[model samples]
Target: MDHVILFEGIPMSKSMRGMCKEEDYAFLGEKGKHHKETDTLGEDWKEEKMERERRRRERAQQEQERIRELEESRKEKEQQWRHHVSELASTQEQRLRDRLARIHHFRDFQRKVLVEEMSLQTDSESSQALDQLLTRI
Candidate 1:
């Protein structure tokens, strides 16, 4: 009697040629064990590949989130710095305006007192000096 092999639900015989490659045959002590092991190994390999891919995608997402947080932080710092600089500039401007106003008031008060204390004809040069100083200021 001739022995026949069933491979994946298909009958195969020794006389068959070009139907399957020689590498597809396994000659171990246990029949069909090599094919079953090959099938299980393929399943395991697919599972491992999918798991690694999942991990890689998760890492990429986490990195993107971290980058977004850093960008927001950097923008916040820049905004704070701009606000601080503007406040300082406003304070300095107000102080300068106050100083200018005080100087103008003092000059006017001095002019009035000097005019009342001296004769205009003899104190013309003094009056001119006061005018020049006020203009220069």
Candidate 2:
């Protein structure tokens, strides 16, 4: 006898005859076009994708906000530095003007004193010459 055999009503290939039992023969119905039905997961998959996109957008927005805050802080610091520099320059200019005014005043006073001393010396010399001429006569 052969190692594989089929029953009278069961229609199966000779190769699969050894793998199936006599009881499995009753389960096989009429065979026609055997198309496998795939499952639909539209709602579940769509919600998952949307959730991931939302998280990504939130992270990007947070990063942009952090950069904006840093820029604002930098601008504020720069403005403060500019104000400090202008104040310092104005104060230094005022001090320089005060020093120049004092120097001018002192120079004018020295000139007046020198002119008065020269006039006094010339008057004394003329008086001495007249006194010498009278003695000789």
Candidate 3:
């Protein structure tokens, strides 16, 4: 008598070549041990594949998040650097203006002193030198 094999509630036999491959026949062994072991191995392989895919997706997401954070930090630093440079330039300009104002005041004071001294002295040589120096300044 010929034994009938069942796969997914359907009868399978060696003559049914279209229904299963030759390797499917290897699942038949003493006490159905071969089929059970094959089923267990298949389930384990699928589970392992799914786990690996999950871990890969998680790692990719983490990398993207890290890159986004780095970009934000870079922009923030750039903005801060620009602000610092602007402040430094403003302060330097103010100091330059102050120095120019003081120089102008000193020049005016020297001119007043020269005028008063020339009125009291008839020394023409020193008067000419002082006038030349004031003109140079």
Which prediction has the highest TM-score against the true structure? 3
lDDT of 2 by residue, 1-137 (tens): 11123344567687787787765654333221121221235666678899999999999999999999999999999999999999999999999999899977865565445446544344656446544533353
lDDT (CA) per prediction: 0.75, 0.64, 0.78
Tell me the tens digit of each residue's lDDT in model 1 across 1-137: 01134343445676674567544553423455577888889999999999999999999999999999999999999999999999999999999999999988998887776566654443668778767755786
- Give the better candidate number (1 or 3) by lDDT: 3
lDDT of 3 by residue, 1-137 (tens): 01234343455565786767635654443436567887889999999999999999999999999999999999999999999999999999999999999989987799678778666363787767777879897
| Clash pairs, model 3 backbone | none
How many residue pairs clash in model 3? Answer: 0
Q: In candidate 2, residue 94 scores what lDDT?
A: 94
Judged by lDDT relative to the true structure, which candidate is superior, 1 or 2? 1
TM-score of candidate 3 against the unseen true structure: 0.65
In candidate 2, how many Å is residue 6 off?
24
TM-score of predicted structure 2 = 0.45
Relative to the true structure, candidate 1 reaches a TM of 0.62
Clashing pairs in 2: none
Stretches of model 1 off by over 4 angstroms after superposition: 1-31, 112-126, 132-137
